[model samples]
Target: MDQETAMRLLLKGATAFFLDVPSGMEFGIDMMSWATGDKFKGIKMIPQGIHFIYYSATDKYGNTAPRCGFFHNFKKSECLVRKWDPDKEELLNVPREEIAQYKTNILNLDQFLAPYPFEEQTKWNGLSSLLTENVITTLCPETTIIRSAMELFPASKTENVKRRRKWGPIRTDDDVGYDHLPNLVPKAESQFRFTEPPECHYPPGSSLSQITKHSLDSSYILEKMAEKHHNVIDLLAELQFCYICFLVGLNYESFERWKKLFQLYCMGKDAVAQNQGLYVKFLLAVRQQLDTVPEDFLVDIVENNNVIYNGLKELFRTLESGDFVLGDDLKDVTVQLRRFLQQKFGWEFNGLDEDDDDEAPVIINFDEN
Candidate 1:
């Protein structure tokens, strides 16, 4: 649903959950961050308690507004998902407390449901749970876990049959029922785990070498021009090198491995420190998604560099996506690169060809207080 509709339909007193976090393990509902708004602090989306999602924005008083949330942290297996109430549209902090229990036969099924959201919800019952629950009625603390294994096939694994994660309380066999009445949760081909792609070698392309030299030369000029300022050209130059290093690190583990040794992650490694940390997390998440990706989506890069890719796209798609650019200073570089690509039959002849223009400046606002 559109963010607007989602806000309208989602219930108030709601919570969210993330199955993975603390960078790579399940996080609490209270720790999730709302996806909307200007608050720079971020949060993970909680995987459970999402039944409260509304299709349109509704204020605490039930008025309509934009929606968002912010998750600060997760602790003790409980989700502390922070949220943004659209009515006020401010970031909120919520903490989930973990409760421990033992396995037992139960009389009231709601006891099993009690550990879940106490309010109304959409139960996306995966086939593994659905099939298992029928044979066994008592759900101890252990049963609630959503196994990643069941997600591979659609409700039915048949061809032309679409797959889904969850269904509402009601189900029409027709919803996932395919021809021939095959089991809705059809068994799968032999499934196997995957290791990350082997790192590829990236020899410095001639085009990349030239651009690198040009960047350093440009930095020198900018340095001379801004002699009165803090003179951050060296810092920019280092960052530029780090960007290449990131691509190098991504393409080859050896390069990154070598980097980690001399790279004392204490104070001087520059942003590479954060990049290295995020890179590991990115790889892990990519591995998780690939576990069940539809065979149809094979070509999409699972290791989504969306933050870098979209940040660049934002400046190109619209002037309003961000206010990161400085006029004239970086504008000339954009014009030059477009002309070069047209003149030379240039392409990403090699990895890290230095194709992107650093037009959108990262504005680091110094705190005045």
Candidate 2:
């Protein structure tokens, strides 16, 4: 953006003031972090948009679960506040009266708040461009105050509620049945433990095998995939949500779930071959997300898991096949993404083909949520 626009954004930015945070607590907003200190408060001049603020409390042993944080979309000139509860080792709500007082005397409070590093605003803008207000509101309704994990219990399991830290809801079979081949359900271990399930499933009573049994054309299979709720937008949203849950929430389960979905789209020969248009659309969506992935998120994925790296290779190999055809726009996205992976991660993608016949099909359930 131009300097004039940048100045305008800074002038209309918001403030986030955290109070009573203990020393050694690793607190962060977006990709930045600061170890707590006595005089430290929070971040200021935050651009008006959706942002991920996360923190990990360190115990005596220095262990952190990293499964806590929240997403918020700030209105222009908003002053958001939170206080750390030492006893609970979590951020707690501040009283409305105190909030009002703090805002009224924000000039005094400014001394404690840290200015957002203006030099990083350009990078921040790139990282968060795709995280629109509508997307954040649709995915996270409790934006003002949401935790990565909240404890809850079913009516029958109320006695055990204390032991359960609910990350999210479990999915039902109907929500995931579309991905399976005809009459074949995945028998994988811990199948019930997926953080999130496949967002696309086979059409009602129709599996890949059953659909292929009829020898349907690509357009017909695309129709089948679209018969349910697995349109391109829903698929992209789930993809974006998974990345946030994994990178921002620091949830491994979400990382695994996302990888599985990525693999399903990029590796599932039957699906890709039968629904080329849908596959191309998904590839485009992935490319769009890859463009705006936060620096921290990209670092985490590259350092922690090679899932995306390997997936990219697989996708390129699949694209090279004569069976799959890409238009100019889709081809540009694929080429650009491949180049980005290479330049950013210093890894060459050789487009090596893989034999998928021997691989085990994954199956999982999904809750309506």
Candidate 3:
């Protein structure tokens, strides 16, 4: 290439960190900050503005893979090359596409493709790789299954297959007035659900105000589950997603009751964006709490996010067992939590033994931050 052409190319591209990262993110001078801690090394600018990054760490383990998170911009503008000099402590730029097929190396591609299981990865980063790496397309095995389940069946036989069907009028269990609810909505068939707790010995510990409120709320979730189950029988008309709806009902029934009292479990899905952000943050914090939590953190199912916390426990167990289980039941997810609590917070709470397991489903929630 001509000198001017080479110079332009080199300037737009430069290595900012030794570790792999997303392409298309303008490292500017903040390349080191973009990478995870400890992996960063240094960068250099080749002639024509091209820059190469160097790292002290290498594949000593014969790590046949390169780990990277590319900072890709969907905007199709060709990026300017860049440079970083330790002496000047600044980043410089060169013309676009300075390096030839930068993402082609097999190792780099593998790292880019490895973060997630085959599920959503395809629709996200994996799809992007389609342009550069053809070998990764082998995921079609699972893709075919998903395709058949989501689309193919529906297209060919709508009557026989149904997952998206809506059923049962939405009833308000929160403080809202049931009378004011849409006239067609289903009414609560019974004020309470379930008989006396199975003959299990009662758990020790009286209710803290928080736990009390949670217990009450959990009782409601259990009631709802039972109601959902019965309603299925009445709506007897049938729905394509009947099995899925029944699954939800079973989970509700499993939530028998709790020792603590709880308030109505109410969270509205307002169309407002600000409210949405708060909800998202609340859910994330809830998940984080579950990750490293005390056994007693479970104030009650109603007060906390049972769906996700239960999911995490099940995931932990699944991981421990080294068997990947695709599931939706929340309570069953407790298989791992039992062991986790026993190990991490062995305060020795009693009622969790056979009596409780036979009497009713256990309710757990992570402690507040």
Candidate 4:
């Protein structure tokens, strides 16, 4: 490291003191992780910004627990302290007094802490730049914990009893069926509070023609979803939030939500021209997001009819058409994104064949009035 860089880190970098964590457990900040050793306390020289801290406990037999993590925005030269609860196999907050004491004795404790891997910072920023403090606070569970495997609770007694009565008594292996299994649901407080997509794609009391248009385009649904946010940018922030949760926190549910949001953005042609600034930002966000996705995942996407390719094809077609007079900024970002996809994934936007059945427009015949 350069002397100036080291000095800057010493003055501004934050520290995380993880106390009494067992050896052989997996611990990480951002995109990197390690199987911790006996001397490992936590990470130091952490850049002051939003980051994810994750860990998993491992048993003596080498079986690792499900991953758990939280997002925290570190302040300049801050000291954060957490203690491991061996019995619970979870990280818990230390008392204010203990945290203060830890900060006071940080110099003596520094030797046990590892420096943050600065090399990964740029990659992390690419994935997380759009995420704001508000986004994390809004979307994360009330407990501020994200678990790879969701914690579930047994269904309510009334509902379970109703199902049991319908299924009747079972005697043997053959009798065991889906209805006989207990209904499990995620705990309310522990579930991510993602903004729910509009239940109905079209507006209430819309004409059949209007309904068909809305169904095909989803611009109305996108507009309704934006109404829930303070502004369009917050919607984009939620998009970023969902991606990070899926990518870094290893949450599959968040991945599903990300797909929903991505689809909404892609299908909203009218909304793009209406919210030009948002689409420009949206394209940039998409570009950054694709960089973080693994090549294997892209292969799976390509095999599954390639929703991303189809979506972008429609979007680029709309921009090229003479219907909308798009701003130069939007046009520039769109060009950059097209070039990026071409270089990164061999995805060509120009001269694309319109062979997809999904692209066919819906036609509704209204009764003559």
Every model's Cα RMSD, please? 24.2, 9.6, 21.8, 5.2
Q: What TM-score would each prediction reach against the true structure?
A: 0.20, 0.64, 0.20, 0.89
- Considering TM-score, which of the candidate structures 3 and 4 is the better prediction for this target? 4
The TM-score obtained by model 3 is 0.20
Candidate 2 lDDT (Cα, whole model)?
Answer: 0.60
Task: Give all candidates' CA lDDT scores.
Answer: 0.26, 0.60, 0.27, 0.83
Candidate 2: Cα lDDT at 333 = 67
Tens digit of per-residue lDDT, candidate 4, span 1-369: 997876578557998999999999999999899989999989989998999999999998999999999999999999999999999888999899998897787768777998898899998887788787888898899999999999988889766666456666533445656556768867889999887767777889999999877877867877887788777788888888899888888898888788778877887879887888988888988898898887898789888867678778877877777377989999999989999998998988765434555456432211111
Error of 2 at 165 (Å): 22
Which ranges in model 4 have alpha carbons more than 4 Å from their true place?
Answer: 161-179, 352-369
Q: On TM-score, who's better, 1 or 2?
A: 2
Tens digits of lDDT, candidate 2, 125-236: 5445445655555444343333454433233333223222352343344655532323222222212222233244444577779655433222333344334333544544
**Lowest summed-lDDT stretch of 10 residues in model 4?**
360-369
lDDT of 3 at 214: 39
